[model samples]
Target chain A: MIKLQNIEKVYRTDTIETLALNGINLHVAKGEFLSIMGPSGCGKSTLLNIMGLLDEPSKGELHIDGHTVTRLSDKELAGFRNKRLGFIFQSYHLINDLNVLDNVELPLLYRKVNAKERRRLAAAALEKVGLSNRLQHFPSQLSGGQKQRVAIARAIVGEPEIILADEPTGNLDSAMGNEVMDILIQLNQHDKTTIVMVTHDEQMARKTHRLVRLFDGSQVQ
Target chain B: MLKNYFKIAIAVLKRRKFFTFISLFGISFTLATLLVLTAFLDRIVNHEYPDAKRKQSLYISGIEERGERARSNSGLSISYIKRYVLPMKLPGAIAFSSRSNGTNTYFHGKKIGIDYKFVNSVFWDILEFDFLEGKPFTVQQEKNLEKVAVISQDLRDNYFGKDVPAVGQYLEANNEKYRVTGVVRNVPASTYMLSSDMYIPYTLTKDDMNTPSYFGEYAAILLAKKTSDIPAIKKEYEDIVRRVPHTQKRFLKTTSLADSYLDAYIRGGSQESKQKVWVYTALGIFISLIVFLPIVNLVNINVTRIMERSSEIGVRKAFGATRKALVYQFIVENIILTLIGGLVGLVLAQLVMIILNNADLIKNLHLSLNFTVLFIGLLTCLVFGFLSGVYPAWRMSRFPIVKALKA
Candidate 1:
């Protein structure tokens, strides 16, 4: 669950000022699957980033799982993120140096899980995503869909309450995009995992339980 | 946790082999220079005054006033010794002096040039020379002496056959025959005062002492009963010299033997001569600084490399890695790199020392590992590693997850 009230994010250069998010108020309940749709410069990703605790709000009240995180220190925020939230990026951002198994095990490593348990949990996550056979394959060797699957497995390996998928299908072909979307949908349905996906595709947005559209810097129902 | 850091460091180095090689080579070259300089300095400092007992011996010389000018002489006039030194009730007061020169001649049919010093009977008591054959001459033999000599092994081998008895055999010196009484080993090349091929009693040739060339003032070496009483004894000797009625007006003052030796060598030359030691010291320090500069530059490069890993740092931070952990990781990485370079540098230095020693570029040149050098090298590596890593680690850890991720 996440909440944002009157959130404002501004970017300033030496000669100009830009409003990334303005007076935005939104909420997502537990186990809810929400898709945020917006044009290129409409602050959709900015809003998602703020909700994921990755960015600070110029003026806002933010609550995640009943704790107000707007005033938390950087160290505290990082700890909160590591324990409660997971991230799946459009680029799949898996460290190329590591294999699929190690990439998936990275989140648990930060959690200080013993190596044996980390390996077991990472293998199980890979198995759930139908990537058990590709555990040793590096991201460079994997197809786009397989990389995305690996990213999803990494996200779920920590057993976090909320998963933030930023343009999850942006880099994949349509068929691979469908497969990634299906995996996300299955996670939301079977495991009751809450997922907030940001995408520009109308058809993709239509598949989620609810959609929040953004124009300029404001959110709309 | 440390294992993980090492693994990550290895991975980084393996991935960027060229960068690693360049950095390592730069560091290793600098370290090698440092090692060489350190070893050389150690040799210079430790090689001086090999005989600890010699420090207890005082070298007494004379300063003569010829009209308006005062000349300090390292050689002792035998008259001064008989008049002042022998009459003193100072126990352990033994004095010896020598005249040294090189001569070439046939030794057992082989042509050779050997250095020779003609000294007195008291020379054996003052200088601790180890004899390989026969015994040192007695004071009675020197007082009631005839033609007698002591030869070094180098001269014995050259003049007589290797197994031939050199003692009691007559050797030609300045066309005059002198019987050999003793044979001693060759002196080490590193010594300032050299051991000689032939030592003849000063009494046997007392007539030669009357000539300024033969006496030239012999080096009057004095061994005190208690070395700690040297200052007092030197003061007494100076007082006796000042009282010796001189026709020159400048000969009115007293001077210690230490001051006399210093006045002879150190003061007689240009001021630059005194500064020569400081020049060597400065050169040593300058070379060390030259080596230090490249290492500092490499440290800066290491800092920049660490900065480039900000994204990885941010991800690690987001994974719950503390600022301390990040610092530790970077410092450990630097230490590992430097230690590798240090080992390579040590090996390189040893190789260089071996080559130089074999070539005889420097006398007795050898690489030695001592506590001071070892401590300095280790401390230098640790301090540099920490200093180089701190700023980069701080900058990396300060990265905002949102900004870094977006970048």
Candidate 2:
């Protein structure tokens, strides 16, 4: 579960100020598959980033999985993120130098997991994403759809409580996009995993359990 | 985790071949130069043969006479050593030697230049030399002004055939023939005072050595019975010097200094404690610059190189890597890089040493990577790795995740 009360984010420069998020209040229950829709510059990714604890909100309170994450120190926040949440980026931000298995093993590394166990779990997660055959393939060697699938396996490798996906299918064709959406649905329905996705695709939003729209840094629906 | 870091580091290096080559070249060249320098300095300051008891010996290298119109600073005369230094109650041996003179000798129609020194028989008792044949001339031989000499291995090889026996053979120099009594190991040229090609008794020289004058081309070596007694010997020498009795009327007062070979090389005029401070400080600064300049350049290069990995850092941080972890990973990567460079440098330094020793750049100087030099080279590599790696690692670790991701 997640909760937010009057979260605000501001970007500042010497001569200009921009409000990225303004008094945003939103929440999602356990096991919910939620999609956020917004136009360009509407703070959808900013909100997802705040929720993932990748960025701090300027002024507000945020509670994730019954913990007040806004007050955690940087080190504590890193630990929290490693143990509780995972992220999938639009660009499939897998380290190009690491093979698919090693990329999936990244989050588990911070947990001090033994290398053997990490490899086993990483392989299993890759299998779940239908990428067992690509374990040794590098990110550069993978196709776009395969790369996105590898990113999904990496995101779920740690078995995090929440998954934040920022435009996971933004760069894929319709068939690949639907395949990714189908995997997310299976994870939500079968594994009871909670996911928050940010997208501009109405069709993708229609597949989710709930939709929230953002306009000019505010939650509009 | 470290394995992963190594994997990425190797991948990145292989991906950026030009940068890796440039970095490796700089590190290897700097380290090789440093290793060569270390070998040369080690030979000069801690050489064996002739000065093996260097720690337990002191040298009265020069005497200073101050007159109203004229001042002179020169080596001690033989008579001055007899009256002022030999009577010292300190438990030690006193030996004096004339400055080496260069002479040309002919053998088989080829000209060979030899440096010769006139030393007292006690010189053998004061310093240790590795003799390959025969023995040092006795005190009686020296007192009798016998025409005998000890020759270096190199000189023997040059004067006689390489495989020929040199002992009991006559070596002619300056039109004077002396039977070689001993063939000792060659002394490195850096040990200038004891590096002569041949040593002969001072009594055999034509010039009067026992002049009452305070200056001559002669220096004395005082070897303490124990290393700890060196201070006592120095104090006794100072007491005798204060009572020097104004030998020359025009040069009314005389002053002199006896010091360790290192101190003698650094501070020549007087043995003041203040001068010792200046000597060590200057040496410290010189060494620091030699070490620090290369590190600064490496740090500059590393900063730019690490910046290119900002996105990788961002991904790690986002996944769960603490700043400490990232910094540690980067430093390890750097250490690995420099250690490879260090191996290359070690080989390069050995090659350079072989070329230098064979070329006869400075006669009799053999630069080899002894244990001490090798240990120092390793330490320099580690220091270079840590110092150059730290700042760039810290800077990269501090990059905000959002900014690094954008980069």
Candidate 3:
């Protein structure tokens, strides 16, 4: 579950100011799968980033899983992210130097999990995404779809309550995009995991439980 | 966690080949030059041969005689040593020796140069010399003005071929022939007063102290029964100087101080503590410059290297890596880089010392990487790693996650 009430985000320069998110109000209940649809420069990813605690809203209040995260210190925010939330970026932000297993083990590393346990959990997550055979493969060695699956595995590896994915299949072909979408839908349906996804594709948006569209930094529907 | 950091560090280093090469080259070259210099300084300050008893020995190097119209400061005279130092009950033994003087000789149409010193028989008893052949001349031999000499291994090899025995052979210097009584290992030239090509009987020299003068080209050593006895012996000598009447003084007062070997070198014929401080401070500054300049250059290089890893840092932050964890990881990576460079430096230092020893640029100058020098060199490398790694790691740790992700 996630909550943002009247959240505002602004980008500033010496000569100009621009609003990335304006007076946004949104919520996703427990076990709900929500997709945000927006055009280019519509602040969809910005909203997802704020919900993920990766960026601070210039003026807003955010509550996630019964805790107000806006007042948490940076250290606490990191700990919260490690324990309560997981993120899957559009670019498949798995560390290139780490193997597929190590990439999935990243959040668990911050939780002080033993290496053996981390490896076991990471392997299980990879199995869920049907990528158990690619545990030793690097990000560069994986195909676009395989990389996105690996990112999804990483997002679910920690068993966080909520997952925030920013255009998880944006760089994949339609076939690979469908493969990734199927994995997300199965996770939401089978594991009762809550997921917030940002996308521009209407077909993918239609598969979610609900869809919110944004225009010029404001929610239109 | 540390193991993971190590794995990532090594991977990142392998990923960027050019940056790693440049960093390693700078670190290894700087450390190699420093290790060599450290070896040279170690040899000068603490030699293991010839002057092995230096820690338990004290030397009265120079004498000063002041009068109304003139003041003369020179090396201790034989008369002054006979009257004041030899009578001291605290010292186990007292010996006198003169400064080295250069002399040349010809053997088999080849000209060979020698630096010789005039030493009393008791000199051999106080200093530990490793003899390869024969024995030192006795006190009776010195008293009888016998024509005998103790030559270094190098001099023996030069005067007589290595195949031939040197003990019973004759060596000619200053148009005088003396039978070779002993052949000892060559003392390194850095051990100022103890290094010479050959040693001859002091009685054979013509510096007769018939006149009661307190100055000549001679020095005296008072070897303590134990290292703990040195202060008492020095105090006794100072007491003698204070009590002795200034008879036949060119001016008014006579004074001299017995000092330890290193202290004497630092004093440079002066009793001023300021001179010692100045020398030590200069040495400190010299070592700092050697270590500091390289660290500054390395810090700049490390900053650039870490900046290129900004995206990795951001990804780590997003994955729950704390600032402390990231900084620690970067520093660990840097330490591994420097430690690898340190190993390479040690090898380089040994090779350079071999080349220098073979070059024979300075007479009897043999430099080796003793344990102390090697330990200090390693410590310097660790310090270099910490100092160079800190600023870049701090900057990277403070990097804004959003901006770094964009990068």
Model 1 spans > 4 angstroms off: B44-49, B52-291, B368-384
Candidate 3 docking DockQ: 0.61
lDDT of each: 0.73, 0.88, 0.87
Worst 10 residues of 1 chain A by lDDT: A73-82
What's the alpha carbon RMSD for model 2?
2.1
Q: B365 in model 2: Cα distance from truth in Å?
A: 2.1
Share of native C-alpha contacts between chains A and B (below 8 angstroms) recovered by candidate 1: 0.34
Encode model 2's per-residue lDDT on A104-149: one tens digit a residue: 9999999979999999999999999999999899999988999999
DockQ preference between candidates 1 and 3, better one: 3
Candidate 2 chain B, poorest ten consecutive residues by summed lDDT: B265-274
DockQ for all models: 0.38, 0.73, 0.61
Give the per-residue lDDT digits (tens) of candidate 1, residues A1-221: 89999999999899998999999999999999999998999999889888888778998899998999999876687778878888888888787767788878877876778988999999999999999999988889999999999999988998888999999999999999999999999999999999999998888999999999999999877
What TM-score does model 2 score on chain A? 0.99
Q: How would the docking of model 3 be graded?
A: medium
**Candidate 1: tens digits of C-alpha lDDT, residues B278-367:** 665777789767666766676677767776676667666655566666778888888787777677766776687677668865433455
Q: TM-scores, in order shown?
A: 0.74, 0.95, 0.91
